[model samples]
Target chain A: MRDLELNMVFDPSEVLRPSSFQDAVETLDSSDSKIVAGNTSLYSLARKGRLENIKKLVDISKLGISYIKEAESQTSEEKKILVGAGTTFQEITSSSLINGRPEYAGLKEALNKSPPQIRNVATIGGSICSAVSFYDLPIVLFALGTTLKFFSKKEGEHLITIDSFFQNPALYGKSLLIECQFSSSPNSASSFVKLCRRMSGYAVAMTAARIKLDRTSREIDDIRLVIGAMTKTPQRLNQVEEELRHKEPSIETITRMCEKSADLVHDIIPSVHASTAYKKRVLPILLREAITTAVERATER
Target chain B: MLNETRIKVRFILNGESRNIECMAADTLFDTLRDSLGTMSVKQGCDFGGCGVCSVLLDGRPVYSCLMPTWKVEGSKIETLEGLKGKELMNLDAIQQAFATNFAQQCGYCTPAMILNAKALLERNPNPSVDQIKDALSGVLCRCTGYMPIVEAVMQAAMMRRKKTQV
Candidate 1:
């Protein structure tokens, strides 16, 4: 379809740039109206004649929601960072709150490692909303236990966990993702790793982990592991998490649990681009690397 | 079912504010090449796969081919068309560096390569080797291997710093 950009094309009937977030949400009244933040992926689909039926284009880039807000957390005394969906990858990578903090190093690395051009224009909201398997942010957020907030004309606003949102992503009806909030815990250490042809290449398999260890006993208090790209959606290693917690934090223990993660993964989506065996083979390697990094970074006191 | 609509988008092109009518589906690559005649933004892959269609959107390097024309409304767009000196006979440091370093063989990707280099140098006047590679990773240079391109960006950076000192 790259060849057809100039030859064959049909335009949407109207392009609306709403002045406010509510106005942008109200534009969803037309089921055919599609919201465009960066238009990196949507325009590609439209050029390929895939979304020929979309009549109206909703522009939400002008909304002031493209920001990163840091405030005290309700769940804990620690501060939480609220990343607006409209925040660009460039902004995320440059923000002191997100990139400057050592705990968010994995997220910063993931955002910075993407194709420099794509990173400049792609927005966090657009990435989560599209929820394509190839995206790097979703897997990182999965391990972070991020909260997604949505707004709609009918529903007003509702908050849901990213895990639940991933479960039934299609349930997003006519809602717009408002922001993604995740806590910053000094005791926890998080790491992200991607396995593919290149840094920006589509993931053959990837994994992320956030681990917290008890200072006195040096035993694991909490662990969240997630694998992506190999599955239809990023799969959380709940079984592996249960196995690793309360165990003494050690390379031997972490390695065993990471190897066990291969069994916890499900529905490894086979594709012509990447064979199932190839993805499965790389899955354990990614898991071990991410988990090891998380373990090394975890504070004992 | 089918529909058609054209929106008038106003943006600063190269340095001048301009307005153009385009279909909502029209990409920045198409509008720059077809309507406004800013052909420097080449269409190498048309899709986002190739960086030959790269442009600086508000001083950030992005693939114009994948971006809708309407997305640039009320924004600054820098293309190779504006990468020049005071006179047509003169060229900017990046342009001269590429020429001196022999960075262009096919010349198809030169415009975007230079534009991307310009954007990178603006933010990072002195970049490390890995930083240079990461910045140019998107813009594919099939000919005249990356050594020359990398050298050109470094030379441009060195020249800029010298000028600042003087």
Candidate 2:
């Protein structure tokens, strides 16, 4: 209901500009306020006549959260790519730290598929918050097992896993996203694929798959499979992952796993654009293709 | 109840510092075209769909239609006006290339195409044909069938390369 109130103007008296990180967190303590990062999607939504009920847009684009680099994560000493909430898609697409790792190629692929102008302006944190199905990068972020870092002046910083964050987006929406980090697994191979009516159009359905085979060669040691656009949010297929993990990825086994995952997806997301029947029919194939690509990439490594 | 608050934001606009009172609702597209008379930044869809309002914000191509005017503080903005070369009568290299290559019809998308192309050529002097296509992928040309525009960018690259070599 909050998305439909229209024609309301964003008067300057309401917009708060916080100069410091701590100040931004403190300012965001107000439950009604929304954060603005790059303002791409929010601007688009307003142009499309959405967000009518919203009054205040706290501009966080300048709150000193802009960063993109590999750093030692707080919970673990392992090196992870810590992309600040304000880090633009342009930064992510071309970040040498992200591109340097073979596992992040999936993220690079998804971000690259976004139009050039969008890449130059839209921030990854904004994309994560938008959580719309057709936005391609969320699928990759989910597939990569990314974790988001949120800061509140009162609560300090909380690192929420992607799975948990999506399960309760509203709980974290008001909080400021400071960084999103993912374990950089050298042994893993990741792939992202999307089907759209037009070459540069928004995705109809997208999949991002990451596969890590055991050193012994045949067994899939770890895997993450996520699908997007069939629903309001990106959905990770845990059952499908469970079926494939710690086992040889045979053609028959992969096919069965994809079928079961596709079935499971029908119960999860109320399908759109591509009908439920269509998505159910095609999910397994796309998942197969993405996983197959990841598997091959893993074998090459 | 809309609160009437205006902030004086300063930015380098076309090589000169200009201060303007920007409201929260004002977009860069509105600020440039409405307030400052920068007609080069066209409002096509008033959203990101049409890249007609593209401008170089700090030398990177971004759709000005969506960029909040309040966000322009301390940033340098370049429109087609900034592409006016050395002399009063002279044209930018990309503009010249577009003209020589017959890259305009109604000319609505021309400014954005030129600016986005210019941003591309600045970072990548000698981009391949595919690279050129990849760079200009955002700026849409509905009238010219895109070949001439793509050729114009290639020619501009060549011209820039030639100028550097000489």
Best by lDDT: 1
The Cα error of candidate 2 at residue B163, in Å, is: 0.7
Cα lDDT of model 2 by residue, A1-301, tens digit: 1111223633334677788768776766665566788787776676555655456678876677788876754344245778888888888777778775668888888888766788887888888888777788888999989998888665788888999888878776557788888876556789998988754568778899998888777589999999888766788888889889998878788877887776686554434466777777788888998998888888787
Q: Give the worst 10-residue stretch by lDDT in candidate 1 chain A.
A: A1-10
Query: Comparing to the true complex, what docking class would candidate 2 get?
Result: acceptable
TM-score for each prediction?
A: 0.94, 0.92
What lDDT would candidate 2 get against the real structure?
0.80
The candidates' interface RMSDs, in order, read 3.7, 5.7
lDDT of 1 by residue, A1-301 (tens): 1224343554577788888768988888777888988776886676567776677888887777799878643455367989888888988888888765656767886787677789988888888888766688888888888999899787777899989988988888588898989886766778889877767767777788888777677788888888878878777889988988899878888778777666666678876667887777777788888878877777632
Worst 10 residues of 2 chain B by lDDT: B83-92
Error of 1 at A186 (Å): 1.2
DockQ agreement of candidate 1 with the native complex: 0.56
Clash pairs of candidate 2?
A: A5-A52
DockQ of 2: 0.49
